[model samples]
Target: MSYSLQKKLVIVSFLFVPVALLLLFLLYPSLRLLQFSLTNWNGISKSFNYVGLDNYVSAFQNPDIWKALSNNFLYFGIHALFIPLEVMVAVLLNNKLRTSNFFRSIVFLPYILNGVAVAYLFSYMYNPINGPINALLETLGLESWIQNWLSDKGIVNYSLIVVSLWRFSGLHVILFLAGLQSIPNDLYEAATIDGAGSWKKFIHITMPGISRVMEIVLFLNVRGALQVFDIPFLMTQGGPGLASTTFTVYTIQTAFKYNNYGLASSLAIILMLMIIIFSYFQGKLFKGKGE
Candidate 1:
C-alpha cells in the first residue's frame, strides 16, 4: 500500500475502532436515555407515549430535583475545599518522616473499601444510640450533640459529605504527591535561597508547578462527585424525607419505585446534559490554568 493509504488504514484500525466502540457503548445509550427522558415509557409493554419536555419540566419544577442539584454543588465545593488537605497529606508524606509510607498507606486504604462498606461504616459511626461517635460524645460529656446523623433532615447530607471526603481524599493526595515528586529539588532550593518563606515558596513555586496536576485532579473529582450513587444509596437511600436524595437516586426511585421508566430515562438524559455542561466548564478551567 502507498504511504497515505497505509496511514489511513492505520488510523481506521487503531483510532476508529475505539471511537466506534465508544459511540456504541456510551453515545448511543446516552441518546437513548435522552429519548426515554422525553417520553412516557414504563419499560414494560412495548408502548411509549411522547411526553415532550414534560419529564424535564417535572424535573425542573420538582423541589427534590432542585435540592439534589444544590446538594451536588455542595459535594463539588467540599471536594474542592479538600484539595488543600490532600496537598497537605501529600506534602507530609513527601517529607519522608518516619512511618510516612505507612501513614500514607493507612490513609489510602479506605478508598479501596466499597461504597457500601463506607456507608455502613459511616452509619455506625453516626448512629445516635450506640455508635462510636456518640460514645465519644458521651464520654466527653457532650451527649447533647448526639443525634441521628442519617435520619436528621438538616444534617444528614453534610454527614454524608464528610464521609465522602474521607473516602476520596487519599486518591487526590496520591496524585498530587506524584506531581510534587516530579518537581526538581533545585527549584525549591533556589526559592529558599531567595529568602522565600514556606508560604511564599508554595504560592510562587510549588503552586505554579503543580497547577496542571491540580486541574486534572479537580476535573476528575468534580466529575466523580456528580456521579456518586453508592454512598448515598447505601446509607440514607436518599431518605429521611428526601434530604439526601441525588439526581441519580431520584431517577432510581422513579424507575423502580413508581414504574416510570420513561420518566426515569428522561431524568437520566437531563443528568447527562448536566454532566456535559459541567465537563465543558472543567475543560475550560483546565485550559485557563495553562494560560
Candidate 2:
C-alpha cells in the first residue's frame, strides 16, 4: 500500500471503536428515548400508540411539573451564587501555603465519595429529632434556628440545597485550583514587577486564564442542578407534598410510579433540550464577553 493509504487505514482503525461505542451507547439511546416520547407507551407494554406532541404539551401544562422545574432553578441559582466563592477558595488554596496539599485533599474528599452514600449520610444528619444539625443548634442555645430539615414544606428544598453545596463545593474548588495552577507563574511575577496590586492581577490575569474552566464549571452547574435526584429522592423522596421535587425526580416518578412512560420520556427530552439551550446561550455569552 502507498504511504497515504496506510496512514488513512491507521486513522480509521483508531477512530472506529470510539465511533461505534458512541453510536451504540449515546446516540442510539437518545434516539430511542426521543421515539418513546412521541408514543403512549407504558414502559412494560409491548405495544404503544403514537401520540405526536401531546405528551410534550401535557408536560408543559402540568403545574406539578412546572413546580418541580422551579425547584430545579432554585438549585441552579444557589449553586451559581457559590461559584465565585468556590473559585476564591481555590485561589487561596492554590497559594504556596504549608497546608495547601492537606486542605486540597480534604476539600476533594467529598466529591470522590459515592453519591448515594453522601445522600444517605446527609439524610441522617438532617433527621428532625436526633439529627446532629438540630442538636448542634440546641447546644449553642439557638434552638429557634432548628427546624425540620427534610419535612417542612417551606424549608425542605433549602435543606437539600445545603447538602448539595457540601457535596459539590469541593469539586468546584478543585476544578478552579487545577485551572489556576495551569496559568504561568511568570505572568504574576511580571504583574508584580509592574506594580499591579493583587486585585488587578486577579481580575486581568487569573480570571482570563481560568475563563474556559469557569465556563465548563458553569455548564456543569446548570446540568447538575437540572438533574439533581439522589439527595432529594433518597432523603425526602421529593416529599413535603412535592415541595422538593426536582425535574429529574419527577420524571422518574412519572415513569415508574405513575406508569406514564410516554410522558416521562417527553419530560426527559425537554430536560435535554433545556440543557442544550442553556449551554448554547452560555457559550455565546462567554464568547461575547471574551471578545
Candidate 3:
C-alpha cells in the first residue's frame, strides 16, 4: 500500500477502536438495563423469571414512587424558574460595571464544591434547635417562621429546592453571560435609539439573541433536575416519609437498601424514558418545530 492509504487505514482504525469500545462501555449496558427492567432477577441469582410488565406496573402503583414523581414535578417547577433568575443576574453582570469578575467568581465558587458537602452543610444550617438560620429568625422576631427544615414534610421539599437554586444558579449565570457576550452591542444601541424600554429591549433583542443559550440551559436544568439526588439524599434522605425522594434516590434505595435490582432497573428505565421525552419536547420548543 502507498503511504497515504496506510495513513487513512491507520486513522480509520484509531476511530474504529473507540467506537467499538463505546458500544461496549455505554450502549451494551443501557441495553442490559432495559432487559433487566423486565426481569425477576434479584441481581444475585443463578436463575431468573421474566416478569415482563409487572415491575413497571408495581412502580406505577407505589405511592412512594408517585410521591417521588410528584416531588420531581414540584422540584422541577422551581428548578425551571432559575433560568430567568440566572439570565437576570448575568445581564446585570454583563453591563459596564466594576467588580463583575469578583461577583462572577463568588457565584461560580459553589459549583466547584462537592454536592454532598453542600447538602450536608445545608443540613447543619437547617437544624431546628441550634442552627443559625432558625436562630436568626428568632433574633429578627420571626420565631414563628422557624420550623424543622428537613423533618417537616410540608417544607422539606421546598427547602431542598432553595438549596438547589443556590448550588446551580451560578452555572446558569455563567452560561447566560456567555450568551450575553455573543449578542452585538450595536443591536442594543439600536434598540435604545428606537425608544425601547428595558423590558421591550429584552423582549425584542436580549431574549431573541439568548434563545440558543436559554435552550442549552433549559435542557441542562431539565436533565439536572430530573437526576437531582445528592441534596435530598444528604439533607433529607428522602425523608419525613418520602416527601423528597427523587427518581435517582429511589433507584439507589431500591437497588441497595432493598436488594431489588429488578425494581431498580424498572425505575431506571422509566426515568430514562421520561427524561428522553422531556428532552425531545424541549428541543422542539427551542427549534419552534412542535407545539
Lowest summed lDDT across 10 adjacent residues in model 1 is found at 282-291
lDDT of 1 by residue, 1-291 (tens): 799999999888899888999999999988888888778888787878888999878877888778877777888898998888888888889896989889888888888998888888888888888899989989999978887888988898899999988888888888888888888899889989988899997888778778888987877776777777788889988988788987788888889999998778877777777778877887776775523
State, as a TM-score between 0 and 1, how close model 1 is to the true structure.
Answer: 0.90
Candidate 3 per-residue C-alpha lDDT over 178-255 given as tens digits, one digit per residue, 9 for 90 to 100: 988998899889988988899998888888888888888877777887789999988888998788888899999999
Each candidate's clash count: 1, 0, 0
The global C-alpha lDDT for each of the candidates, from Candidate 1 onward, is: 0.84, 0.94, 0.87
- Tell me the tens digit of each residue's lDDT in model 2 across 1-291: 999999999999999999999999999999999999999999998999999999999999999999999999999999999999999999999999999999999999988899899999998999889999999999999999999888899999999999899999998999999999999999999999999999999999999988988998999999999999998999899998899999999999999999999999999999999999999999887894422
Q: TM-score ranking from best to worst?
A: 2, 3, 1
Positional deviation of residue 74's Cα in model 3 after best superposition, in angstroms: 1.1
Model 3: worst 10 consecutive residues (lDDT sum): 282-291
| TM-score, per-candidate, Cα-based | 0.90, 0.95, 0.94
Give me the runs in candidate 1 sitting further than 4 Å from their true place: 1-20, 288-291
The Cα error of candidate 1 at residue 1, in Å, is 6.2
- Checking candidate 3 for backbone clashes, the offending pairs are none
Error of 1 at 41 (Å): 0.7
